[model samples]
Target chain A: DVKVTQSSRYLVKRTGEKVFLECVQDMDHENMFWYRQDPGLGLRLIYFSYDVKMKEKGDIPEGYSVSREKKERFSLILESASTNQTSMYLCAREVGANYGYTFGSGTRLTVV
Target chain B: DQQVKQNSPSLSVQEGRISILNCDYTNSMFDYFLWYKKYPAEGPTFLISISSIKDKNEDGRFTVFLNKSAKHLSLHIVPSQPGDSAVYFCAATDQTGANNLFFGTGTRLTVIP
Candidate 1:
């Protein structure tokens, strides 16, 4: 079975602070994604990495950026944490098109 | 504008019953549909999927149906168990799929014992 792990299961950050959420996948998938889920809004993509050092913006990439320094690791960085940025962050990896994604446990970020 | 929609925000079902979660999409170009189930504090996991060419796909107790004309698809869970309680999300991809997915507002399912 494929495993996707996130650095933290819960996080709290002060306003204007920088926040980083890390994800790593055991499988050698080519595609990695970052998503934030909110109540009433569901999961919205923040960013996705197709390869090491390669990234693409998702529909809701504002205020967020991502880095892929290694094939197994992807990181989400928030330049300035805001209350609105608090949400459940998820990481996923996929091998190819139309294939189902393997997801990390998730990080619940709270910005106060 | 949200391309995918799940009208029902929450659903409750009795154990040993059938639970149906519905999803609708506005884009006609979407050719692949998938269902994901997420537990509290966990990421969404792939449940089942159906291709546009076929209307129905099944995996044990979980089955997914697609209606191209209606641009609607649904997930049916038979003999629902308490373990099935979770948030069900409907997702789609255009012909190419390439890892980008449009997801619907998830439906929280509660299976009563």
Candidate 2:
């Protein structure tokens, strides 16, 4: 089974502080993605990396950045965290032949 | 603009009955649609998917139906079990990026025994 693990299950950050969410996958998938799930807004893509050190903006990538320093690890960075940025952040990895992605348990972030 | 829409916020069905979750997309470029199930405090898991050329795809008790002209897709779970209760998300991808998917707001499904 494909397993995606997140570094933190819950987080609390101060407003205007920078935040980093880490994710790792054991499936050796080439594509990694970061998404924030909000009530009534669903899951919006923030950033995705198809290859190591290569990142692309998704439909909603503002105020967020991502890093893929290694094949198994992907990180989501909040440039300047705000109360509005507090939400459930999810990390996912996708296999080449299939569109189904394996997602992490998710990190619930609260910015006050 | 919301490209994918799951109008239903929640749905309830009795155990052993069937649950149908619907989704629609405004973008014509989207060719692949997928359904994912999520439990509380957990990430969404891939349930099933259907391609544009195919109208229906079934895996076990789960089936996905796609309507091309209408730009709509629906996921049906037969003999709904209590364990199936969760939030289901509808997602789609276009030719431009096979890996980039747009998701719907999702529908919370409840199965009562």
Candidate 3:
């Protein structure tokens, strides 16, 4: 089984503070993604990395950025946290074609 | 504009009955569809999937039916159990592209005992 681990299960940060959400995978999957889940909005991709040091912006990449320094780790950075940025953040690693993705347990972030 | 839509926000069904969650997509280019189940505080888990070439795919008590003409798909859970209660999301992607999935808002299914 593929294990995708999110460093934090829950986090609370003050507005204007910077936040970092870390995700690490046990496998060698090259594709990793960060998404934020909101009520009635579904999962919106924030950023994705296809390979080490390669990153692409997803649909909603306004206030977020990503870093993929190594093959197994992907990190999402919130430049300046806000109340609206509070959401359940998810990390996923693609297994391969047709196999779909394996997701981490998730991190619930709250910005006050 | 949302490319994929889940019209039903929530559904409640009695245990041992069938629960159907629906999804629709506007993009005709999408060639692959997938269903995921998410529990509270947990990331969504891949449940089942179907290729555009096939109309139906089944796994255990879960079956996904796709209608290419209508650009719609549905997931049916038979003999629904309490464990089946979760948020179901439908996603679509064009394999020819970057493989970025377009996701629906999701439907919350509640299985009553």
Among these predicted structures, which one has the highest DockQ?
3
Candidates ranked, most accurate by lDDT first: 3, 1, 2
> DockQ for each candidate?
0.69, 0.64, 0.73
TM-score of each predicted structure versus truth: 0.95, 0.93, 0.97
Tell me the TM-score of candidate 3's A chain. 0.97
Considering DockQ, where higher is better, how would the candidates rank from best to worst? 3, 1, 2
Better by TM-score, candidate 3 or 1: 3
Across residues B2-34, which tens digit of lDDT does each residue of candidate 2 receive?
899999999999999999999999999888888
Best by TM-score: 3
Sort all candidates by TM-score, best to worst: 3, 1, 2
- Angstrom error of the Cα, residue A101, model 3: value is 1.2
TM-score: model 2 vs. ground truth: 0.93
Consecutive 10-residue window with the lowest summed lDDT within model 2 chain A: A93-102
Where does model 2 exceed 4 Å of error?
B95-99
How much is the lDDT of residue B4 in candidate 1?
95
Candidate 2 residue B17 Cα shift, in angstroms, is: 1.7
List the TM-score for candidate 1's chain B.
0.96
Query: How is the predicted docking of candidate 1 categorized under the CAPRI scheme?
Result: medium
Instruction: Compute the lDDT for candidate 2.
Output: 0.90
